[model samples]
Target: MGIIKLTNIRVYAYHGCLVEEGKIGSDYRVDVSVKANLQPSAGTDNLKDTVDYVHINRIVKEEMAIRSKLLEHVSKRILDRIFNEIPIAEEATVEVSKINPPIGGNVEMVTIEMTLHRHNHKQQSEL
Candidate 1:
């Protein structure tokens, strides 16, 4: 097993409970990490044999574009799409951060993180 991580993906999005946040938007940083079998791709040097980082980036961008009240909601959506779209991804974790959040006080950011395993999803589906 191996991990592929895409870090500090910057995006401008409107995701917050505040009305002004929806209208003006804010800067967001997204990080995604996926684990999969890398032996095949490592040996063959073929893109198809591994979890594609480009696809993961696209998923993050697409999901972040949608408006949501909380970072947890967006984080879950990102994880769900990673498992559903990338079959080779055995597990994934996503971190969504809102830079300079409006929660008062001197805070750098507010972040929401979520992790999902493919097996867990399958088990849930079977129930």
Candidate 2:
């Protein structure tokens, strides 16, 4: 019924397609835009009012820190952890970016963005 947006959350981790890349960790930037009803939190203004952003970052960082074979998997894991750990978030769009990839291309960073909705499909239905 509403929207909550979180942007530019960065985490340093070691996950990549190559071996050395994993050995040498890099910065991972995350931008999460979640859509849900925040009426209760808005009105209550209590600690339990809405989804805790602090805890959300912790979940994302922990999930991203895991050594995954693919950025896609990492993104999905972070997304899943957020939805599972934070019940108030109905749906979330996670953009996971790798700073200065080791590919043979001219780019400062390579980003893998994944969008996932909350369980039961009611979250995306609002959008």
Best model number under TM-score: 1
By summed lDDT, which 10 consecutive residues of candidate 1 come out lowest? 118-127
Over the stretch 33-90, how does candidate 1's per-residue lDDT look in tens digits? 9999999999999999999999999999999999999999999889888889888999
Cα RMSD to the true fold for all candidates: 1.1, 3.9
Each model's lDDT: 0.93, 0.79
Summarize candidate 2's per-residue lDDT along 15-123 as a digit string, tens digits.
8878897888888788877776788878988868677778877877788878887889888777777777777887888888888888889889888877777764445
TM-score of each: 0.95, 0.86
Screening candidate 1 with a backbone cut-off below 3 angstroms (N, C-alpha, C), the clashing residue pairs are none
